[model samples]
Target chain A: MANGELKLLGTWCSQYVIRIRMMFELKGLSYDYIEENFANKSELLLKHNPVHKKVPVLIHRDRAICESLVILQYIDENWSGTGPPVLPANPYDRAMARFWAVYIDDKLPRQLIDTLKAATEEAKAEKIADIHAVLELLEGAFNKCSAGKVFFGGESVGYLDVTLGSYLAWIKAEERIVGAKLLDETKVPLLAEWEKSFLAADCAKKFLPSVERVEEYVRELLVTKWKVTSA
Target chain B: MANGELKLLGTWCSQYVIRIRMMFELKGLSYDYIEENFANKSELLLKHNPVHKKVPVLIHRDRAICESLVILQYIDENWSGTGPPVLPANPYDRAMARFWAVYIDDKLPRQLIDTLKAATEEAKAEKIADIHAVLELLEGAFNKCSAGKVFFGGESVGYLDVTLGSYLAWIKAEERIVGAKLLDETKVPLLAEWEKSFLAADCAKKFLPSVERVEEYVRELLVTKWKVTSA
Candidate 1:
């Protein structure tokens, strides 16, 4: 057992923060949840996660971990003594799982950022193109993942689902703001149903942000700051 | 053993590719290597990785998984039955290892990309600010990770070294583009030595691109693309 109380430092709005929280919930781990006003950085958060100076930073007794995806793997590794395994017992499945997670994290963000930064005609055009490209890729990935099955795992949700679900929450909001769309049923049909299934899933439903709020926030972002963020 | 032959579609300059190659080497799995030309992406590469159309795609038989970091994890899981484990046996150390890798992969690139983008004063200033912020945080992280000893794992190279070593190859080139320093003996001294130790690790040195070439490419990027890119 860890030497001290386990604590998680995060902002409520952060999807990554929600992810680790869900992992803890699924894992049945008891821990302290410390909210940080990201607008005002806290000493504890700063000390625990100096590199990113962000959350959710999980303080495991004395040790702290800063990355959300990494934290998920850690929690799964430590707490997955029983119940549904977060990663595949088989190596190939686990790798594929990690691949999807990393793909969304690494590739999707760029498209989203480009969309967020679209102000001019040319920039908006470029961002839209980027969004389309990402959507195509996501469609391929999710369809392959969902091959004759429901989730990233054949039967149900796994770590990859959690990560992707978190990411999907922000896409529409970003699209609305950037004045572009990503997932249309006709376009990325796989994602359309995946979103439906994911939102309907009790875990994703609880962990994901309310769609209404996300929509409004994304609209506001598009209307207000997307252009002036400076190239 | 897997049922099919493995093929790796990758670019020569990609840090992610190098990381996966190292993992393949570490795992003692023989894979067919096919280099990709980003400008003229091959049909095989496109078919295999339709989503990203990027390098670092691994093919097992005919099923392909794209993304380098993801491939690294996949390779670890698939081939780790008899070889040295890529993930640590202990969960906490595994988290720490993932922490470093994710930090390098996700956060480090922003600053390095900024340095690569040839931009105006405003863009340069924004990028410089971003670079400084990341460096300051990394400084603290290095200190935190190094509180006890030299390596992320006592004295041996682990996951962190793999990610960080791959990235450090680009830093010198990025430094040339920025026309300002980020890592220094005076600034991030711990990280500086950490870099030295990372590069000196077995097989790590052989895997990376030449600094001179990277610097040259980075300089060219600064002249042509940095402004538009970081902007």
Candidate 2:
């Protein structure tokens, strides 16, 4: 069965959008990347995802799938035989992959935003400390999930890899803005190494926005949206 | 493969726990249900789920899976052939199911908590209004997903059904405490009808905690945890 007329509505600098792009790259699936302007969202985007009206809406066969995680699962399930499976074959491993992916989604982004929007040095440090704690936990998870392998998917870039890996550029940008090492090689050596490998992976390399690009975007976001000029 | 030594560690009044219990009933898989005391945290629960230290942990063959949504998926995949499929088989429908399920989890609980913790009548009304808006959207979703059928899963209970259905008791309890009809039949007729069918379903009947029980538990929660005297 043909997955006809696949179209993706997204913005350039969104980590969530990058996750879907990375999935398409890994699965060897091509899609029409429709870049959506945040200031003025497209009707297609709005019509497809009215609830959130956020980006990363994948329109396949004229049906739109909103939410990046949901979209990733749809692609994996729909294209089960196309390439290396995004989720693991074993049910337990798949569950573990989802557990960590959800953990990343739940924790990392909020902390990153807080770090960027911190009003004082004291507050920024506090947020950084929380992020470090989260990273340490993720480091342990990486060790458990990888089990002496290359990625969270053992050998290939699986769901967890795409999930956490999508934030690599943003983490770097936050580090640049805040003057703190988030993925510290000494503290969370595993994640630090994983970051290096994930960035170099063929599937992720082109999709991940450069740290410099993300830094510029974050600065603009702070000024225009969040009204935080201190950063 | 035999699913060996299944055990569930959860509290009696937790809607999340009820979701797992209902899934078990739906699949006809029995497990030892160990009720955990919230004040006196169990070492086993802590050890199994170190990160969140939350309940609704499903331990199978000495492996623990935490998070309600993740556990539901795990159960569905592990016991795929044993029972009626919880998630829709079609990729697009599955994505829609997940999309709606995530929406319910993301929106409903926080609004309910805010309603409970509202210090002023105005604030409570505002929260209730938000909840009603969410419910209205869900009502539309129910129409689309059910497609004139009885439940969100069409003929049988599914991921979205279990996810949102877990909160039915809590919704009723909130209505009782706040003196507001959250699921107004006049406003959301489809959801109102769906609620009746969900409660009467064989898989969910014995598992769903009664409205009175939930109300009592929520009142206790307000006084003890949230420190609200006026509820």
Best by lDDT: 2
Evaluated at residue B15, the lDDT of candidate 2 is 78
Instruction: After the best TM-score superposition of candidate 1, give how far the Cα of residue B102 lies from its true spot, in angstroms.
Output: 2.5
Tens digits of lDDT, candidate 2, B1-231: 354499999998887898899898888888889999999989989999999998989999999999998899999999999978888898888989988988898999899999999999999999999999999999999999998999899988888888899999999999999999999998999999998899889867888888998999999999999999998
Give model 1's docking category: medium
The models' CA-based lDDT, in order, is: 0.73, 0.90
Worst 10 residues of 2 chain B by lDDT: B1-10
Off by over 4 Å in 2: A1-4, B1-4
Clashes of 2: 0
lDDT of 1 at B216: 76
